[model samples]
Target: MSDQTGSAGVVLKYTVSPDDFTRAGEASSKVKNILKQMGISPDVIRKVSIAMYEGEINMVIHAHGGEITVTITPQEVLMELKDVGPGIEDVEKAMKAGYSTAPEQVRALGFGAGMGLPNMQGCTDEMKVETELGVGTTITMSVHMEDK
Candidate 1:
């Protein structure tokens, strides 16, 4: 998707494809590049990259693809991931390290170590998850920009 800028902020939109491990990190990479080009602080860039990458991978592995919208402003970066796949059953359990519901096949790929949510939380200043058992899930994360 094309990037857009408006009074609200600079918005970047991407579509994560299911089971596409080879292309999974494209969005995060693009965002990182944009942040770098914008001269954002390295710390904030690093945090946003890690959190967005983890969320993108989760969408690919569990959610069967989704949409990622990132809004960058002077104060903070906001990332929203929305998917229509099977929703998370337990948010708490999912947040725990080494606890995962990913299938054996997914684990074989060296992913699904159950660190996705935890790592995302660790990197972002704020995060929120909304899910329904059979419906879908949406995760919103934010990393506040710090004064240099």
Candidate 2:
């Protein structure tokens, strides 16, 4: 971890492993724990945790593997996920609930329900997805924090 100099927040980075369902939530858990230690409100922590977790799952199931950068500031929490894999074919179609490209086996593992992106969107104040077929995908999500 780098020094938190000149920055109003903490930036945490994690490398995600593809197809690692058992460890999917590890990054999110760590972020949530850090937020708790920092005394962030439960609502804000939940929003950040859930959104990042979905992004993590997306990376594992769709992008093989990826990197997540989470920045926590007094004003907002920002999460950026970048991956090198087959990008999303249709962002609109993928955003719909119950739509999934995950294989049957992945579905049996309790993921690929097609709600990852939507849940991410719902949890954050703003969400942006940049992807190119056969290239890669990057998702940025942010949630604002209220004055305590």
Best by TM-score: 1
Top candidate by lDDT: 1
> What digit string (tens of lDDT, one per residue) describes model 2 on residues 1-148?
2325246678888889887878887888988998999998899998998899888888887788888888888889888899998999999999998898999888888888889888899999999999999999999999999772
What is the overall TM-score of model 2 with all chains considered together? 0.93
Residue 49 in model 2: shift from native, Å? 1.0
Give candidate 1 regions above 4 Å deviation: none
Residue 93, model 1: lDDT of 97
The per-model lDDT (C-alpha) reads 0.94, 0.87
TM-scores for every candidate against the unseen true structure: 0.97, 0.93
Q: Tens-digit lDDT track for model 1 on 1-148? A: 8788998899999999998988998999999999999999999999999999999999999988999999998899999999998999989999999999989998998889999999999999999999998899999999999972
